[model samples]
Target chain A: MNGVHDMGGMDGFGRIEPERDEPVFHAPWEGRVMAMMRAMGCVGGWNLDMFRNARESQPPSFYLTASYYKSWEKTLETLLLERGLVMEEEIVASRSFSGSTVAGQPLRAEDVSKALKRQSYERSTSAAALFKVGDGVRTRNIHLPTHTRLPRYARGRRGTIERVHGCHVFPDSSAVGAGDDPQWLYTVVFDGSELWGTDDDPSLKVSVEAFEPYLEAL
Target chain B: MTLRVRALETVLLEKGLIDPAVLDLIVEAYETRIGPRNGAKVVARAWLDPDFKRALLEDATAAVSSLGHVGEIGDHLIAVENLPTLHNMVVCTLCSCYPTDLLGLPPVWYKSAPYRSRVVRNARGVLAEFGVNLPPEMEIRVWDSTAETRFLVLPMRPAGTEGFDVDALASLVTRDSMIGTGLPKLPEVGP
Candidate 1:
């Protein structure tokens, strides 16, 4: 879905403001939320794509009200509830039901470190890359309702293959219900003139990692 | 932020969804450990050793892991060099996918709508807003981190720091420099 989170080109938000000596998190809860999100990953089913999709699924109004970590908190709640790990009333009442959640591994303190290191998507396979470095390719104009790694601005745009990042799990299929299907990943370079037109700085070049299915021979 | 998260915690604790001790551990890890300094060390090491830099650019996961800074978010990392001719920037247009293990959490601005929306289209303008006014002739390359390979911008070694040790060079790698929104500061000029 073309959610509001896909804010690549559309403007009017504000300037990119960087604070001097910015802290890792703003509030204490933000820290807890970050920890919870990481801990919740131990529950075992959802991938990063699903987590991202949930954050993006938020309605514009509520999404706007949330600071970056607030958005993470909201989605974490929704995902837990939907996964049957927590109940809506459980959250409301601030207590667990007798059989509130299904059997799952509780994230012990030690497991936190292990959990952080686990779940690597990088895999080795015998498949060879379809496109090599320096090959020119065009991004397929794919607009999917499901989660995707392809950004909107780069779709249908032409770019030169900068590097081939071996075969990695394809998120478009994996993010949904599909199994882990490895695809050739290429870092494609797009000229500033092509992406932004003549008015912007011509010296700028944008490069993005394009999946195999999202690209065609140019 | 404290009130809302505390309230949420109260609910979760009552509901038996979270363990307080475990929560504390996670907080400690993110707050005290696991952050940009790890990335800084990696960048600093690369500056000190060309072999490590080559290995990092070729396979960031192994090279970074050799330094003992690794995590799930950085299952695979692609360290892009910000050379004299090329200036690299990283962003996840689909979502805010960052190397949390290296940089801790992303700064607020990186996750903001303005930066996410405009960086892909107007990187020069966006960099300007971030106070990175690059020369027009210098090539700017924006790495849209739209895949599993997390990006870390290996900023160019600042000039006139020849005698500095790895620790001193490590101090120069800022959070923004790793993100490519800003450059590592030049060593302080002396009288």
Candidate 2:
């Protein structure tokens, strides 16, 4: 979507100062927000990609100014509003007049650990990969208005395939309520000069995982 | 912000859409049970055992899962090792996609605009701010976690730790070291 969230090379933001002894959450609300997001995932209507799109699709002002959990909170709100899980007035009133119609069992406290377990996105495919290791390729200059893994900086740039990560769910389609639509994933490496105009450091390289749909034969 | 979150929670709870007990459990797990200490243990085991290191470098998912360190956002894991002539770091340019199961929630700096926008373009400069001054000749590889594949930088062990056990070595494996922003703690500095 070319949103401000796709921040790669565009600069002018100041230096990074790592906090000393940083806590898991800055406030109690942050933790609750995180837990709420995870718990909402158990509701089963939307995928992870949809949650991310809701957050990234926000206005630049909100995306930039909102803290991490604040973004999650907004994303949760956006998802709930869109899914009709809760009404706007209900949120404002901080209570529910009518019950939600969203289908899915609530995540129980006993099943929290199981719900938190990692789920594999890698899906088997009968098709062969278009590119292999050491193959030269160029990233397709795709600028979709939907969620995509292809960063703007590497779009249309030349790179070498480093590794084949097997087929995985394509975010572009998944974000829009499409099915798995898994594609071959590869680690494509580009020289620093290839990504940026010039490289001050001689030995600098950048790499991104490119799906088959985001690549073209060079 | 707090009130908004509380309000949202209130609505969800009143609507019977989510369980409050589940929320508390999730929060408690991340707060007390899971974190970078899990990644540190993995790194320490890899440093001590060559076969495990090779397995980790080959297939990090199975390796970490074998150690029972498994959770969401960590299903597809990749471990990039740092050497004398080579260094690797990770960033999700589009968003804050980190290995939450291994490192708990990402640090604020990782999700901030400055780190996300600059790390790929000026990793050396970014690392410098993190007190990591790599040699000019050494190659720097910046990994953008643009996909589901999460990354963990297996930082090189510090010198003069010949007899250190896994626990002792894990102490030196700081969270930043695994993120490739800083090297492991030196022996004299202590864990």
User: Model 2: per-residue lDDT, tens digit, B1-191?
Assistant: 88888999998898777888889889889889789998899999999999999999999988887885443345789999999999999999999888777887789999999999999899999999998898889999999999888899999999999999999999999999988888999877457
Score each candidate by Cα lDDT. 0.80, 0.89
Chain A: TM-score in each model: 0.92, 0.97
Stretches of model 1 off by over 4 angstroms after superposition: A124-127, B1-17, B68-73
Q: For candidate 2, what's the RMSD?
A: 1.7
Clashes of each: 6, 0
Q: Report the C-alpha lDDT of model 2 over A75-123, residue by residue, as the tens digit.
A: 9988988988888898889899897797667878888887776577899
Which candidate should be chosen as best, given lDDT against the real structure? 2
Winning candidate number (DockQ): 2
Shift in Å, residue A154, candidate 2:
0.4
